[model samples]
Target: MRSITRFITTSDIVRIALGWSAFGALLLATPLLSPPVPAPLLITALVSIVAVILVCAFGVVRQAEALARRLGDPYGSLVLTLSIVLIEVVLISAVMLGPGEHATIARDSVMAVSMIILNLVIGLALLLGGIRHRGLAHNRTGTSAYLAMLVVLIALAFGLPALIGQDGAYTTAQAIPVVIVTLALYGFFLFRQMGAQADDFTEIDERLTLRAITSTEPDAAAPGIRDVLREHRTEILTRLGLLVVTVIPIVLLSHDMAALLDDGLARLGAPTALAGVLIAAIVFLPESITAIRAALGGEVQRVINLCHGALVSTVGLTIPAVLIIGMPTGQAVILAETLPDLMLLTVTLLLSISTFAAKRVTAMHGAVHLALFAIYTIVLFS
Candidate 1:
């Protein structure tokens, strides 16, 4: 009884109830969205679906966090990153497979996520964390490894196609090799990240470690990751199970949500790129919060793992999946960015290299990143 009480609290029950209810609502409401509906009904459906997805995403984040904290370091971060990416993949795939010309959704969503995580999320993390704790320290080795992979992957996934005049898509001859290479490179990174070079992703600066150790008093409200591990000591499998249940509804519900989003946006005459931004925001909303919290807690390395690691997976994995899906569906998967956006991405990547080149980051770094994000927003709207 005590174990049950500890594992499933009142809040858990409430979230679970809402998640399942949302699942049912999606089934019933999806049909209504197939054809034109009254504005009130459309708004109601959109609002409800958005709410359900958000609620369940938070629940999923909670479970994933428990799992991540319990496992520790790279493993824990890996779990959370992979779980979020899975949800992203499902939502993007759902949107792609839906009606209308969504060929570029995969590309746009990936681009939006890269900007949001790299600039917006990481920028805020550094700024807020720096204010509270002077400079945000992280493992430069791991960060460099992640950036190197990203530069190469981004060039291959987004740039090469454009350069070769494929216009964001590769011919069958080109795609086969690209997919195989992307997957293999990602597999290599994973092997190193989880195996031989795992420490690169989780290493803490020696001075920071000593400071944490010598500190006599710790904040009670801001419990460290260790506290979470002890609390969820025996709930690994249980939490993992809960994670799946929560993620499933979001995945299924996304199909309907994507449909409504497309129809609504068309009616409103909003820019189509906004759909990608919205999807990216929705996909990573909870996870971004989790990263920021980690940042504020002075877990800069963990924040890196979550934010940088996520974009790595986002590009490494998403591109291949999009390519594969495009191959079969005969849909033109436009992965190329416009020249201006490409320039922005290149600057962001270069800036990222400098941001983490030093062992510690200051508030200024964060501001620069956020500035870049602002520029991205302007470019997006323009």
Candidate 2:
């Protein structure tokens, strides 16, 4: 037992490596294996896709926990955002390139993304955080700013596309310009986020000091920049390495998962919109677990930052990437015309109202969110 615990085994690394390797193989095989299978057989494909996502989710959570321990919240936020965007990009790209089954596929996808983040991600995070901390306190300024940015970005990337589709003026030529400008704007935002301008937009939670799980003490009067860099060099490298290792497998698994989802959805007659929702779930699973942990540990600020920050990142970064990529391909991803967007809009507004009204969440709130999630599922199938 002692030997097993203390020594590193080649078999363990092999197992980890094989899991990812198999995923890569599957991704490569999927396009080649375009044999028209029966709808019932697609069930197996769906299960396999879900399994890949589960493995991806588990790996992400473990790596994110390690990152959170070392780099504090800002860097951790970057990790979460990158993972979600990568998955979204992969899934969207695959669906757009695949059979042109759903005309409003992109619209459904964007709506599904919004619903999953607001109704499921934010809802569950707040609920779990509330239950853990009783009455949690987060940075109101950060939350409000994030919400405003999310609304604007979503309106631009998703809402405008839907409206354009309705006007029947969303030509491939027009789409090319839209995508170019959108990508440029996203690039600018990303640069600002990682540059000196970050300080102007970002606000550190006061409550972060109150719940210092593994963060270093804020040295307002302490060392020089050189001293700080030298002291944390090893830690920074380790965190970066962890993130890189985690992201490689995540990308591989996501690629395979995308192919499997296409096969499964085609086989099962499932709505393609559900694809975005599934991708959102997989991407958010790790962050959701972290949010629950922070809430339980009385780190409400962390929960809020994670939940809202991820939502904003998904909208701002991922949607733009999809639009930019899909526009050139002649894939006009639009919202579903079957149901009023008003219903989804109302749910999101209700969730925001509930979250802000009390500034806390509880098990009851979780139940409510779960109920809404159930309603969403029902609507999808119906």
Candidate 3:
């Protein structure tokens, strides 16, 4: 009872209450949305739903962070990345399944998420950390592991399909092997991350920063991952339960938001891909704040995990889920990016590798990433 009381706070109740209220309100409004509606009314409803979804998402991340604090690196960061990606997957699925045809929804969301997290969030993190501490240090071994997996996954998901297919989509036969391979690889990566390679994902102290970054090998000490389940079983269970409860309304409301987004964008004659950007933004905004905060505190490794780790999961998990969904529903999901977008992604990946290769990253690296993001934005809007 005492633990329960400490766990439940006023803000917690309010966030959940607002989530369910929006869910109920919009559930009733779903029918009206099917018909032609006033533009003002349509925009208002969407704004309301987007706002509430973000609130609940913050609550979800809040609980996940609480769990992360107890669990520590690797597992803690894994928990956070998975939670955000789950939101991304759910929103993409909702939009795909909801209203109009959105063949490129999956591709666009993955690309938008990659560009935004990799460039925008990361750029800001590096800039701030650089200014505050002259530069910030990150665990390069773990970052390299993440980037290697990411490079292959991104190439597989975005590049290969465009080269091989007619409309940047796979033949059913090709998709099967791709999905199988992608998940199999991700599963193996997770296995390594959780076991012997856990220390690779953690921060390096100033005294040990050089060896930690340049060793190109795991530490001989082999600091194994903490068995948090054994150590903090009760608190972990409590947070997991709260996380689920907070996530439910966001999941439910995503359908309503999807419908509104499709309708709103169609009305505005907005780019179809803009819906994907918005979905990525909605899911990522809160977590981006956390990443910057970590950067401010000189936790560059955490920022890498949040930003780099997110794109890895975004490509690793989202592509497979999109394929799985597309096959069954006959949605004909498009996984290939356009040539221009492809170029930007390639540059972004290579730049990230250079930025984190050194003992520390400074504003110079961040500025370049931000400039790239600006170019991506111009292409997106123009």
Per-prediction TM-score:
0.86, 0.73, 0.88
lDDT against true structure, model 2: 0.59
For each of the candidates, the C-alpha root-mean-square deviation to the true structure, in angstroms, is 4.8, 5.8, 3.7
Candidate 3 per-residue C-alpha lDDT over 1-382 given as tens digits, one digit per residue, 9 for 90 to 100: 7876678788888998898888888878778877476788887887788788878877877887787677877777777677767766777776677778988877777888888898999999889888888888788899999889989999999999999865989888889999999999988888988888878888878868667777788867633345558766777777777776776677667645765787788887877667767766766765687788778888888888888878888888888888888888888888888899999999998998888888888988989999999998788877
Q: Which 10 consecutive residues of model 2 have the lowest summed lDDT? A: 3-12
Better of 2 and 3 by lDDT: 3
lDDT of candidate 2 over 1-382, digit per residue (tens)? 4433332234434435655676666667666546564555456655664565566556556656665555555455666667666666666666667776545555555566567766776666666666665665555555565666666665665555546654422456655666666566656755755554444333345455556656676546534334544776665554445445555564556544655576667667997656656765665666777766766776665665677667666555555555565566655555323434546556665576566556455657666776787788878776
lDDT of 1 by residue, 233-266 (tens): 5686567767776766665666556667777888
Q: Which candidate do you rate higher for lDDT, 1 or 2? A: 1
As a TM-score, model 2 comes out at: 0.73
Q: Which ranking of candidates, highest TM-score first?
A: 3, 1, 2
lDDT of each: 0.81, 0.59, 0.81
Model 2 bad stretches (over 4 Å) = 1-16, 27-49, 94-105, 162-230, 258-272, 326-339
- Strongest candidate by TM-score: 3
